[model samples]
Target: MQSLFFKIFLWFCVIVVLVGVSIETSSILANYYETRWQGVLHTIMPMEAEKCARMYETSGKQAVQNYLDDLQRQKSVRFYFFDEDGNPLLDRSAPEVVQKMALNKEGLNRIAQQNLSAVNPRQGIAMRLVPGPSGRKYNLAFQQSPTLIMPVSEAVGTHPYYRLLGIGLFGALLCFLLTRNITKPIVRLRSAASEIAAGRLKTRVAPSVRRRYDEIGALGRDFDLMAEQIEALVAAQRDLLGDVSHELRSPLARLIVALGLLRQASPEEAPEYLSRIGQEADRLDKLIGQLLTLTRIESGVESTQREKFDLTNLVQEVAADGDFEARAHAREVRVVSADACTMSGAPEILRSAIENVVRNAIRHTPAETAVELTLKQTDDPKKPGALLRVRDHGSGVPERLLSDIFVPFHRVEGGAAGNSQGAGLGLAIAERIVRMHNGSIRARNAPDGGLIVEMELPTSWA
Candidate 1:
């Protein structure tokens, strides 16, 4: 019973077997009460019946009844004696079918002419006519042995239990099929779960399970989805650890070298050594700060509260900041085209992202050139949003490396990883923050020269 297959199989088997037995019993009983008479046994039946009649004539009705009773017990045969007019000769009750054959002389003659005695009690009954003490005819009816003709007027088969055995085999087959249909999918799912628990993050349910159009299919699909997300998060985490350690090692080594130089240097050289140490410490701090920001945004810990603000104003403000910083490098930041567009997002977070892009452009633009910005709203049916473009008039990033710019610690070999350049985390942080606001960002080489970064974002109305 503890096994579901056994429980279901046994219960179904029992119910089916019971139903089969009931139907068989009902069929046998129906045949039992049937009025149709079976032909004579041609064995001890009519002969014994003649003895019953002679015994009745010699010893009277009671003694004949006793003799007949003894035969009934030993032979499983019932004897009925009738006079020539269809009246009972013995003090015993007979079935109505027997009485009917006796009363209908024509029907009785038709059967008797053929030397056969017709009787009821299901099959196996027989009848015969004999002379009585008064020199008149007598009809004697006796049933055949029930064991030979049992359960119906039809004769018994060679084997008594064949029907029951067939029914049992059919029930077992049905139960086996039913249990297999239900438990097969469950077994697959359990195996998948076990594999996953053993650190096989890529483990998935079989296609057979997933293709099923039922709740189990839905569960299988959801399980695969969860595994996919878990794998992605784990890989990202592992990469982050490796990148952080690699980035930290460089600055630490430099700081250690600077500390050694400072302690051994003369008074005049000490300040320079100390300053070098300070710069490495500051760079290390900035790198760590950007890492924290990226982690927060990626981990969904950063607040995403939204507010409506003018995109034009935010762009102009960022340009002014970049321009002020650029002035020292003989460069300028300017807004080329501006359209007043309102958008919804965490304003400070978006400000950081936009500022990062603008400053990166300013740092890359040539000393005599200007970094250009444009802001406008689009009404495309597929994506109604505002598109902001920032262009830097310097050597653009390599086309092959454009997509890599947003990855943490990614830097173009000869374009932006110079000794004086900032750590390559500004664009990475920008990408994460922009993604948090449900915006898309990408970079491409400008037509004439330099590089253009475009950000498409939904406006408040959109």
Candidate 2:
């Protein structure tokens, strides 16, 4: 793929060259016509032919013919002469034009009315009529300006085509060179990103071109800053996990050893001690597993392999697993779905997230209360998404603690009063997993009197 900077530079150069060439070509053509008009005016004399006729003893046809020939040789000029009756006495235009004008009476009348000094300035042709040797006779002189007669097509010939070809070839070469110069740093940045994605946390874009003070240089600086931050955060997280694990390991090992010793001392006390030890071990194991899962997700070591799956099946499975736990608390867990729903994401992660919500509901609800697990697909066809909700008919979470419910290790004061079985990482992990799939999880108190945990997952197939 091409870099953004190179594309922008290419478009900029194209616009600049096009506008420059257009203005230049227009100016050149205008100046050419202007200079030719000035030259033609300098060479020809503007006088009434009647005045010339009164002064001259002989016919002035040869002198006017010679002037017309000289101007025609430089460019292209047509000349014509008419009498008092508007008859062409002397015509030196091409044979075709002479024949056409001979048969045109209207043209002859227009020429008579135009008479000598009366000429349209904008038109290329100029005319002057004078009295001949007799008062009844006249000399109508017609001279076309060289500027308007010269054809641009013939003037350019082949030189302009060759010049344009050369310019286009040179421009392409310049664009290639510029694109290379701009994309070199981008290529380096891309390679560094690939390396980082491949697990090389130290990979970074070089700042060797910082002195250039361009977009590339700015990008290099930004890339380096981003790399540094990622490295620091990763290192700090690893260190914190390591320290927390080490601190927990000692006490956990000691408790297991103490329980073994108690079992050896009294066979009757063994059952109770063994059960307590099992509970402690389960708690420690859950905490360690949660920490590792959180770390993997946070460090980007684990990515969700999103794919379409039946939301109904996932909700049913999670609710089934949490049913026994709800039964132990004398609460009934019901999985209700009015319609089949489909969602996209890592199925295992999504299952875990839903299971956590169901487990939380079951743990918080009072005895004989019902913990409802509902799956609903949105009605809007354009906005296709599945909502998995777990609602418990118990003293719901307070308004103040609702916002912090999804935060890691944050347990509600009254919610966790009776239950010490969890380390309060379930909702946090659920939230992280949901967000990884580009979904959202929220907790709120239902108006009917219970806390509802809703998870919304987007799906392509509604």
Candidate 3:
């Protein structure tokens, strides 16, 4: 009773059975009455009575008796005869009730009025008269025993009760199958939901169920989407905790060492130790700030503050600042090309994202090398977006590790740019910000031997 499948199946069965029984009961009663009455009237039709009367006179009493007996055995009817003077022709005794009936003027007239057919208490009798060659009148009576009506022995087809049983069985089977089809998808959704509740976040309903074009199908698809979101959120939370722990350990350790040095150092060396401690504190503060920014972006707490602005100018400003900083290391940051692309977004957030990439490029490229920036309007009519590419002439990332470069705290190991120290939240935060703007970001090795980062934002944001 608790199972949805069983409940639907049983309810369908009850409805089918009730309807089938009602139909069969009414049909059987109607058929039985219609067939019985029609056959009863046919048996004692006036034409049949006349034919039997003629035979009785021509074939004589004995032969007529034999014919009547055959009719009685086949059609369940019997015959009685009397002379015109009211004398019995064949002395076969009939029941007293039939004798009384034949002698009564009212009963006889009633039978004649109906063409010699009449219904008594239990049976129907039909009678007729015929004339001999000498014009002598003879009276004839047809009677049935046990009941007045004759039963039709040769009725066609199976009995009505059996037919009803067959119809009920077929309806029950159809209902059972229909219920299974209706509830199968629900059963699968239930199982998947149970698994998910039991901590199996990856569980999902079958794809076929989701493809069904119905309300249940829509529910299944929506459930899968919810589960995916939950899984992503859980993973991001774990990654954030791990990233914070790893990134804080180095700065904290430097602070501890600086503190020990301050305790023993003379005044001349004390300032340097204090400065080192202050720098470590600054690094820790910066790391915490980056972590908070990443958390806000990843968790969607920081809603997009969109406004119209020129993305080209944003890129130029970031590149210009990077160029000023790169001069200290004999490196250059240059805007190779620019396009006039007006956009809508949180300008400050985009500025930070773009500036991080530009500075990182300048920080990693070899002294005397240049970091190149390009901005262009995408031509695709459907997308109508802007693209920004940042490339550095440093050694390109390893092919296998390129995919992991944007992961928070990820650093390229033993590459030409590996000498620089970074907490590695820049690209990760940049990617999140790009996605928030309904954009995409990716990194690849340039053909001329460097790393290239491309970012695209659609025109809807413009």
Candidate 4:
């Protein structure tokens, strides 16, 4: 009973068995009463008695005797023919219980005078008196299997108990099938849960369970979603740790070398060595700042102050700053086109994200090659957002690593080989910012052989 399968199955089985038993018992009792009632036996005796009396009146005792003998052998009914007096014409031994009933004058009077039927103290025996031809009365008695009867086992095969047993077995089998159908999916879910708890985040319920059109199906779907989210979080955590450690090691090694140089150099050359040390320290500081910004954005710790702002103005401003800075290396930044498009989001964060992408382009594009910015208002049904494109005229990233270029600590093989001053967190931070505004960013090799970065920001958050 502690188990649901057993509880439900057993209850169903018991109910069905009880109903079957009740029906079989009622049928058996009805049949037993039908066979034993004196009225049932009497209903047929009058007709039979009349037939015998007519045969005796027309012919002799031989015809009537033949019918009596055949009836006794086939139906176990004994006939006693008598006149107005209490004298039996045919000699036949009465059963002892019936003999005693005959001695009760009051009972005999009730039977003969009222033409009623009666039973003796013993079961399976009944008596009735019927009027014969020529005013003669016949005493009729019927005994159920008096001397000849089938064996108990042979008779039981057709008894109600046998039918009841068959019905009970069928009910039990049906209950077992029903229980299995209900519990199988639950058991599978439990097993999957156990596997996931053991750190197997990919473990999931079988397709059969998920296909169910019930509450269990919904539960299975939820479990699968949870497992997928957990797997993604764990993978991201591992990647973050690996990237952080690898990025820190470079600056730390440089700082050690700078310190060693400061100690070995003469006092007159201390300023130059000290400058090298400060550069390494600045590199470490920038790396740590970028890592913190990425962490805050990814973890949702930094609350965004969303407000409506003109995106076209912001891009122009970022391009202007980038242009003034890129002039140092003879690289230029200019907007090729602009459209007044407004969006709702944290203006500061968006400014940072756009500035990073533009600066990265300026840093990579070859000298005297102006980094072009195009702000186009799109109405395409599939995109339905503003597309901001930044193109740098430099050796584009390899086709294989185009997707990974935005990953933190992931730099192209030779995209920035000549200039190794900036850390590789610019594009990664840009991607995070774009995602926070419910937007998307992607990079590809432009048709004219330069790297192009496109950022799409939705006009509406919903």
Candidate 5:
């Protein structure tokens, strides 16, 4: 997997697993040998003790000591041989852990007891009795599991090349942590980016990264915000696509049903089915046209041919036309103030944007309620722009769902105008066109009663 955490974890696991398995295997084998040697000592210690007796009588203490020394090295068992009176056969010291099995009558001093307190104790001392050649008894006491620790070279791969590599890695890791405190966050961001690129829209930078006050942290926060917007857009697009399919299916299905009825009908009923078929065809055409307009606006195709035009003139023209259309339905569209301001963009597309908003308001406003339009140049230096406000006398959108009105095919299901008569691409197209022109569109409820749709267009364009 292309996972940073997985990669790092795998690396650490490999090193630990290697070291652990090696040490564990060595220890297991060493323990097995230690056990076998302990068993063999039982069968042979007495024989060796008797041999020591003969060696001391004939050869000398030196020869017996040499013999025991060889056995200690070969069998890896520590020995402490003594006579019946408790004198060591060899001229060598033993660990205090095993000294209790063979001690002098005078016993150990207080200093020795305290000094040896820190010494680790073995399980027990293995003792064997043997008959001397001169008929005296001698005691052989030894400890099990004499150290089987391997040399550092063999145990740790301390060959020249490996040693250099290990040192280099250690130094690099130290330098990396010291010099690149930001790398981890960058890596996390890269990982998050990769995750999103792979279609995991919800993937986000780790919260630890976001909590930092540095640039990397800011980047993480921005990255997460971008991810959220992208996820929302993708979800909205998916929903729009599904809605488009469903919308298309309804009209196509109605057309099919109408055609079937027309085929089975007598001449008298054919006219009704033909009219119904024509109505379905017109619905499909309008939906498809609206879908195409939305696509063009979102893709910036409609606004490609920028031209200087008077927004005041554009607003008045749309108002007059909307007024004429609305009056037929007992509603009216009127301009409150058409401020004389000019801007560069596609006037026809901008015209479409204004028309859509006015039409929506007209559709929702009660009979005889005027859909009011306001246009003015804003004085805010940071955002010098032209603002348009369209207010309608109707039930406002729910506070929580005000922003959703501009989403394709999303309608505010309130009041008389909440029907699904439209494909719901009108405000969505207008929203995109305004954004492409480096402007913004937003809707909020007026304080009195009704919804206000605001559009802000920048004066200058790049």
Candidate 6:
């Protein structure tokens, strides 16, 4: 009753079982009545007919009447008889009975036929006594008293009550089991949904593979899809914010530095200051352009045009650019190639990312220090990739902050002294561009000296 499915099933089972029991009970009552009627016809009726016959032959009419009267007192029975001409010879109770018998021509004819037949013919007892013989020569008609009908009614009524009660109990038990089976899956789905609502984005309803292909399985599948979509959207939003912030930081830093220089200069030095400001402005413009390129790449707006490209050539070009700034810082930039490496990606973006890494190494090293850039290819088929390593032997980064060094605007302690002109976004921008090309970049302290940054680009052609 506590569950809707249970209540409905219970009602249905009750109706079906009750109907079945009612039919069965009715059949049983009918069979019992038939048996009881047969007993009365075969045993009691025959015995009464024989008794009437004996009285008619031995003791005559007065003895017959006395015997019938005695039977009527003991049991609810009536008796009568007629002679061969179909005239009433002996009748109990009243003289009017003989006259009433004479009026019924069909009764008299049936009685006369029973007496005339050579073989004895038995008739079944009935609720109403029609005009018929009592299956004996002397007795013309007989019937049980009206009170005997009560037993048949009693048999039908009592048996149905027990059958209906049994049906009700069985239906209730079946309903409880059915309701529990259906609600268990619903409860699991509710719990899974609640967990997801509470920010457990990975939560999923366990699929019941054995269950039927019904509404419950559909709901579970839909819930899994919803949770997956929510997780994807949340992840995309976070990446968007991080990319935007990193892109804007470089240009803004250059502009700020340009303004600071202008504020601390004289009119005679205006030309020199203006030249520096122009250079910074150009740097800002270049930064903005690179940011737009990175944005388009990361957002999947621009499809990568991949082709076999020489990795060593790309690294040499990036090294040449870094060398230009390295010369100004009095640093020696060297490119060491171990083997000819090849890869497939948008060359422009890969070049930019590689250039950023080399530039950062050049900017952070000490004067006259050797900043080595090495390019190599590995033989691993599962990891067919080009490895680019840039190492700078200068004041190394703190071990504790090494992991966060690639984060945008995350400047370490040594960063302030060595790379004063940088906005701390180079490594961050490089990592994003590399990841957009399905590559990875990492920075770690070199065993011998300063920081070593490594970039790996997969070269799998298949």
lDDT tens readout by residue for model 6, 173-249: 76766666578878888898899889899988886822435566667788888989989878866875686577566
User: For candidate 5, lDDT tens digit of each residue in 285-309?
Assistant: 9999999988777666776699888
Per-residue lDDT tens digits of candidate 4, residues 1-462? 335456566777776776677566556644555554545555666666567667767776777777778888886656554333434445566666655554454565577687666664234556555566676655555555542222232233347576566556766777777678678989999999999999998899999988876677778888899999988989988987987898889989988998998999999999998998898899999899988988889887654678888888999999999999999999999999987778888888889899989888888899989999999878775655789999999888888788887887777767731237767788899999999999999998887778899999976322
Enumerate residue pairs that collide in model 5. Answer: none
The TM-scores of all predictions, comma-separated, are 0.65, 0.50, 0.68, 0.67, 0.58, 0.50
lDDT score of residue 147 within candidate 3: 31
Q: How close is candidate 3 to the true structure, as a TM-score?
A: 0.68
Better of 2 and 3 by lDDT: 3
Deviation of model 2 at 72, angstroms? 44
Model 1 accuracy (lDDT, Cα): 0.76
lDDT of 2 at 52: 45
For 240-335, candidate 3 gives per-residue lDDT tens digits of: 688789779989999999999899999999999999999999998888899888878876766556788888888899988898999999999999
Candidate 3 lDDT: 0.75
Candidate 2: where are CA atoms >4 Å away? 1-243, 246-271, 295-307, 416-419, 460-462
Please give the clash total of every predicted structure, in order.
Answer: 1, 4, 4, 0, 0, 0
- Clashing residue pairs in candidate 4 (N, C-alpha, C atoms within 3 angstroms): none
From the highest TM-score down, the ranking of the candidates is 3, 4, 1, 5, 2, 6
Better lDDT candidate (3, 5): 5
Q: Write the per-residue lDDT of candidate 2 for residues 1-462, one digit (tens) a residue.
A: 135566676667775786578547644764565565555443452343444454343646666556555655775556565554546554444344433444454554565565424333344444444445565545444445545423552243324774455456666776776678678877888888899889898987766644446677777778778888989888866765665666477659867786777758677877777776777777778788988888777766555466778878777877777887778768888876635877767888778877887888888888888788887887779888777788887678888788788866667766621245666678888998888888898888889887888888886553
What would you estimate as the lDDT of candidate 5? Answer: 0.76
User: In model 4, how many backbone clashes occur?
Assistant: 0
Candidate 1 regions with alpha-carbon error over 4 angstroms: 1-183, 381-383, 416-420
Which number leads on TM-score? 3
Please list the C-alpha lDDT of all candidates, in the order they appear.
Answer: 0.76, 0.67, 0.75, 0.76, 0.76, 0.66
